[model samples]
Each structure stands twice: as structure tokens, then as C-alpha cells.
Target: MINLTGKVAVVTGASRGIGKTIAKKLHQAGADVVLVARNRELLEKNAADLGAAMVVSMDVSSADEVQAGFKEIIREKGNIDILVNNAGITRDNLLLRLKEEDIQQVLDVNLKSMFFTSKSVLKPMMKQRHGRIINITSVIGLMGNSGQSNYAASKAGIIGFTKSLAREIGSRNITVNAIAPGFIETEMTAELPETVQKEMAESIALGRFGSTEDVANAVLFLASDLAGYITGEVMNVTGGMYM
Candidate 1:
């Protein structure tokens, strides 16, 4: 079993879906978790349910909010051993019909948030000389979809960002990696048309859409000491969809 006892972890988008599961799994592995999301009520409820060490309600896409939120977390916890960049959104539209605002919103929330959150945690992580930064990207980023150009671009950006940051901080013993999940069943995926959902499932070699636990488990491994030597890598939790 992977042990993260005494480690402090911060999981953005922790109120629901894969992020929520990741937070719970890290907590189960003995890390003190801090839940970060824009929903205060949901975050508080999850924190109480999971016995999380802290809860920070903020818009992660906003650099000011991310910086301030991390500052507060460090002030109270003294350090952050793990950072999960899981806050993202998809504004799906065909290139011809995609709105300027939709593209910008997707980029800001999906890609820029990672930049902000990763920057906020670097100081504390570097000071400790050890850290794990796991970014939740998507297989869509690797193999683009027809109507998800904006989302694909953002996720692809995450892969580049992860590798670049990993190279920059590997000397500090800070491992940065990205988790690319494909067709994971979550609130977001549930909204897809039945035909689309079935088509997605058929594409996966595993013969089914993945579960939130699948992605969460991958996040757990990347966050643990087991992945200490692994950096500048993308771990696919996609059931062989892209490979």
C-alpha cells in the first residue's frame, strides 16, 4: 500500500467528480487533505465527510484567488507536499461555430488555472525540497475530438506545461506529471447523448467508460513516493483509448 502519512495535499475542484475522489483517496492514504473549489457549501460538506484538514473556496482560474488561497493554506499548514491541478471545464463547439468567449473561457479555466496553481505551490514545495504536482489532463488533449478544439488545446497545453515544469524543478526533487483520462464517467460525461456515450465506450479497449476511481487511483500513485523518480511523464488512465 502507498503511504503518505503526515503529508499535506491540496486538491483543486475537490467538491465533486474525479477531484473529489482523488482528495478522498489521498486522505485515506494518510495525507492531510485540503479541498479547494468554488463552491463553499459543497466543499465544506466534503471536507466534513472526508475529514479533510482544510477547505478553500476560490475561483482557481483567477490568479489572485489562487495565490491568496495558497498563501492561506501555507500559513495554516506550513507546507504542501502534494498539489493536484484538477480544476477544469469544457466549452465544446465546432471550430466554425465556436465563440471567442467559449475558447477563452476553456483556456482560462483548463490551462491557465494550472499555471496559477502550480506557481502558487512552487515556493513551498521547493523550500521543502520534495513535492508532487499531478495535473489532470485528458485523452482528448492527445487525440483531438471534432467539436472540442478549445478543450483539446488546453489539455495539450497541460502536457507541455507538465514536462517543462518537471524539467525545471526536477533538481528540487519536485516531480511534475500529468494524468490523461479518457471517457471517465462523471457529472460532465453524463450529459452526453446516449449515442455519443456508447460510441466513446466502444472506442476504449477496456470495453467500457472508466470510473472516477480509475482516475483517482492514478492520481494517488502519482502523488505517492512510488512515483518519486517519475517526472516529465504523462500517465494515461484512458483504458487504452489513445494507445
Candidate 2:
């Protein structure tokens, strides 16, 4: 069995969906997790259910909140062994009709938040000289999509950021990687119309949508000791959607 005993991980967007499952799987792997999100009630519920080692309600877009929250974690736990930047938003619109605010919001949460959170945690991780940072992106970021211009751009940005950071911190034993999920079965996918979902399924070589667990397992692999030598690679957990 893969042993993750004694690891300390912080998963942003832990209030629900893939974040919730990632939190659970990491806990089961023996890591003490810190759950962060904007929803206090949902965070609390997840914290209780997952036995999260700690909980921090912070807006990923706000630098001050991310700084303070990471401070609290460092003050209390001394360091974070794994950091997952999973909080993101999508404001789908045609390029011509897209609003400036929509573009900024998507970039802030999907891209800029990783910059801030990764910065805040790096000091402590460098001190310990060991860390794992995973950014959740999308296959659309690689292949592009019609209406998700903002999302695609932000996710693609994460891939570039991950690669760059990996080079900067590889000497310190820090591994940075991005996971681009294909069409996964989540509340987000469930929200799509049946016709859209069917069309998407047809495109996947796997002939179906991936589950939250599919993505979570890939994340666990990257965060665990098994991936210590791996860094800066983008793993596609997309049920063969892009391959």
C-alpha cells in the first residue's frame, strides 16, 4: 500500500466536488489535511466528515486572505508538505461577448491564486526542502473549447506556471505538476444539458466521463513518495479525451 503517513496537505476548493474527494483520499492515505474554501458551512461540514486536520475559509483571489491563512498553517503546523491549487471559476462566453470582469475573475481564481498560494507556501517548504504542489487544470486548456475562452486561458496559464516553478524549485526537492481533467462526472458536469454531455461522451476515447476518483487518484500519485523524482509534467486524467 502507498504510505503517506505524516504528510501535511492543504487543498483549496475543499468545500465540494473534486476538492472534497481529494481531501478524503489524502486523509485516507494518512495525511493531515487543511481544507480551504469560501464557504464556511461547507468547509466545516467537510472538515468534520473528512476529519480535516484544520480548516481555513479564504477567498483564493484575495492576497491578504491567502497570506494570512498560510501563515496560520505555518504557525500551527510549521510546514505544508503538499499544496493543491484547485479553486477555480468559469464564466463562459464567446470571445466577442466576454466581459472584462469575467475574464479577470477566471484568471484570478484559476491562475493568479496559484501564484499567491504557491508563493506563501514555498518559504516553509524550502526550509524543509521538500514539497508537492499540484494545480488542477482542464483538457480544454490544452485542446481549447468554444465558449470557455477565459477558462482555457487560465488553465493553460497554470501549465506554464507549473513548468516554470518546477525549474526554479527542483533543487529544493519541490515537485510541481498540473492535472488536466477531461470531462469528469461532477456537479459541474451534471449542470450541463443532457445533449451537451452526450456529445462530450462521444468524443472521449474511453467512451465515458471520468469520475472524481479518477482525478483524485492521479493527484495522490503525484503527491506521494512515488512521484518524488517527477516534476513539471502535465498529467492528463481525461479518459483519453485529448490523447
Error of 2 at 181 (Å): 0.4
The list of candidate 1 runs beyond 4 A from truth reads: none
Cα lDDT of all candidates, in order? Answer: 0.93, 0.93
Q: For each candidate, give its TM-score against the true structure.
A: 0.99, 0.98
Candidate 2 lDDT over residue span 1-243, tens digit each: 666788899999999999999999999999989999999899999888975459999999999999999999889887899999999888988999999999999999999999999999999899999999999999999999999999999999999999999999999999999999999988877877899899999999989999889999999999998999999999999888898
Local accuracy of candidate 1 as per-residue lDDT tens digits, 1-243: 999999999999999999999999999999999999999999999989986459999998899999999999999999999999998898888999999999999999999999899998999999999999999999999999999999999999999999999999999999999999999999999988899998988888999889999999999999988888999999998898889
Q: Kindly give the stretch of ten consecutive residues in candidate 1 with the minimal lDDT sum.
A: 46-55
